[model samples]
Target: MSQRRPVPRLAALDGLRLVAALMVVCYHYLALSRSWGHNPVTVFPTLHRFAEFGWLGVEVFFLVSGFVICMSVWGRGLGDFAVSRISRLFPAYWVAVPLTALVVKKWPEVTSIRGWDDVIVNLTMLQAGNNTRNVDDVYWTLFVELKFYVLMAIVVLCGVTYRNLLIFCGVWTVAAALAPSLGFPALAAFAMPQYAPFFIAGIAFYLMRRFGSNALLWGIVLFQLLLAQRYIDYRMASNLGHVAAEHLPSWPVRLIIIAGFAMVGAIALGVFDRVQWRWLCTAGAITYPLYLIHMFIGMTLIHHFRDRLPAPVLVVSVVALMMATAWLIHRYVERPAGQWIRASMKRGIEDVRLNTPARRKARWRPSLPAAPEERPLHSAGVH
Candidate 1:
């Protein structure tokens, strides 16, 4: 039999989510030159140096997500899994997308509006898959996330046992490795060679958490870390210009990635299991909304106030404002909206179930052959 371990509440991960969101926030506000309408490197020389590495936080988020998702979906069916994901992701996203579009229309500095077509498409959260522009650039990650969810859905369908999960990790790792050499776009999209390692490592770590680490799990994590490094140049080139990317050493990025792995490893090993505090959950509650709304909206605010406020003051105020807004959205909007979505989706899924042929047959009756016309029996020989 496959092993199972009781999942524990890891509030520290919630805190970690907030930290990752802040890292990306800092990177966007402090290190990204284009968004500021001037080189941030010149504006905040010292902070920029540190903030430049903050994009690694996204990697950390992916790792945490793999662990969290695997944990959440352990005993869930596909419908339940879909409902959970939809409920969790869409509530804040539905608000953030249009709010961002309106803000962009109002400011028009952070990015140009491609039109309502893009806005409509962005609402689906499949904009990245459709080759459409995302209203907020941070949304590109959502598409990657969606693909991972699809992959996991398959695992969920098969059942998320320890043995099956090990098979999944191995198959996915092999696929991700082969994706680059095969020149298959579909395979590459699904495997996500650049990002797969983080998610895979996260799953492996979770496996270690559940079943206890073995040579295989340890090997998978270590192998993925090495495989992950191959994409460093690709990430740097895409994020920074090739010339500017060349100026930055890859080691810092590599080290940060390693640290992210180490942190999750620590979590899997129960290092942070007892470090729980209630506020970390609240911090986590705001993370999704903050990440979704921060980019263009914060940039627009920064662009407008660059001359009016001190850089430090402006950045602090904006981050605080964003966090405050995220909290409001989480408290006032996400919880209720998520509940509504979950209820609505569950009802809809139930409706589908009731309408399926098998379910209909189970509910069906054929009148019991009219009780065999009830008249003829006992008189044939000896009444």
Candidate 2:
């Protein structure tokens, strides 16, 4: 039997994650300031314009996630995949929920928590489903991520193959494209067809890299590009309006998106296979916690210090503090807690297996005397 090689960590992907997380931080910092009636744009007009496009970082994250997830479960069983995902997600998320709630409660900005019910719902990470508001708006992405995981789990359970993935991508794209027109907007929202292309693009890149590129993979990549363009156009029209969207130099934004995708492809194709940096991985490791905890805390700090500190100083200080806090949480809290939880779960599963009736029967089954034929057909046929 051939043993499968372990997948190497993609340092470029980690680097990309660091960039994406920072972009989100910038976006939220600037956007939240404006929403809270503080005009950072007036103070730092050029920086604000650049920050306006930082929201696209989430899409970059989605693309990276699809690739990482496919790589993560490549050779694992469904149970292993589930355990891996749960361990990776819940520990950081659970910690962040209460921390965010505490910050919002004390600060009481646009994201004030009503009571314990809200906190409880936030802890569940199902605030959207439960019709409760998030303690922080950033929690909404967690829901999207969970949905992606659930869908990916289903795909994994069904068996992840190139053909299977290709079919899924195709069907999902069609569904996403026609959802609103078909009056099944919920399908679009839940399945995230609008974003499916990016995920599909990631999957396609993975397939191309792992199995060697082919026409089908190339086709999927092209399709994703088309879908992404359409989505961008629609977003501009619907979300930002033509006038506003037009005002924001389109080429730079398009170039950024294209460059991001290009970089992902290059990394997937081994262009950066040798670029391994531990510091980049460390930076990447804190992204989830940083993303989850940064917004409310940073905003509260900004609100408190807007008058006392210069805009640039406040932004820098908040970003630095949040990054430090995230590093601490990732190091001291998330890693240790996740390890303990996984260990405990493993022990519980082992205990259950050992105590189960089938296992018990197998364990204590009597060893009867061997029959003549089974007694070992010795060379002399002694039996």
Candidate 3:
């Protein structure tokens, strides 16, 4: 059995999943609040402007995803990685995107996506900047995510390995840092190259698996992310977009931020893997669908009830309602989909096999990658 691939197991990552989903929900709440004429900034003392940076929760997710998915790709070739990713992400996303446009917002523009052309491109999971004209903009991250997955899958499948992944990360981080200076926001070759660091960092972290770098890394990242918010891009404040990475730190800072978030995710994965609560675990399972749908629901609810609901009460109620709805959706939609996918993947696929001892012998370090040989065969790698 290749140590690089391993079987899937349930862990407390669910709770963290729930937290990230809620953070995004709250971030959207803040955005909706402002949109609906209830800017908490003016109404509530001590309220921060971008309390909505909670949407950065997706970054945490990206980091964790990179780490976990890298392992999945390490042993097997790219095809398996691609299949796994599509199976894991597409079912939910394909359902979610159209769901957001039609089911929640009911916008006619969604009809723009009606034919085989857009549907084929979307099903391919390759369009991010090219297809940003959708009704729900938040989905762009999923596109970025899908791109990273595909890129990573290709690199791993080519047998280029971490030495190559590291080079890819370095080049990616540098290019992203210099993206705007080059006069392109989309950076035709990469997915919003600026955000690539987060995804790259996750891949690097998974390969390295270093524990010595933990709290300090995260503290610095928190401080920096907070600091970046301070230099708000007038555009964002003008409701166009407040910050742009137009003048971000050098490559070192980019790597540091990636390292920082990677640490945050790895520590989270380690600490919560042993939790015993079913509800908490269940909450984690629905995070993707919850994340996908909550903004529309929350924003819609905020728009409709803004005049009647008290500002603070509306905020709290929306959050609570969204959370409950997330749990329900998890039970009804996400869990079933994940179960069906896993079952199909497990029952039908003929891939590498490994013993439980091999898995138990595998070690996970904070923000570091496991050597290919060091990872267990089945669950270790997603492929």
* Candidate number achieving the greatest TM-score relative to the actual structure: 1
lDDT of each: 0.87, 0.77, 0.56
Best by lDDT: 1
lDDT of 2 by residue, 236-304 (tens): 554345776877666766777787789888877878877777798888898989998888888888887
lDDT of 3 by residue, 1-383 (tens): 53543323435455556776776676676643543656545654444334544555665677667666766775666545655675667566666665555544353321234443554455445555575344455667777776676677667855645456656665665665567678775564564444554565566555544322455444433443443332234323433243423432234333434444645455434543444576765676667767776766567667667779787898888777766665676566655776677667754444434322334544564456757545433343122
Clashing pairs in 2: none
TM-score of each: 0.91, 0.86, 0.67
Error of 3 at 35 (Å): 4.6
Which sequence of candidate numbers ranks them by TM-score, best first?
A: 1, 2, 3
Q: Which should have the higher lDDT, number 2 or number 3?
A: 2
TM-score of 2: 0.86
RMSD of 2: 9.7
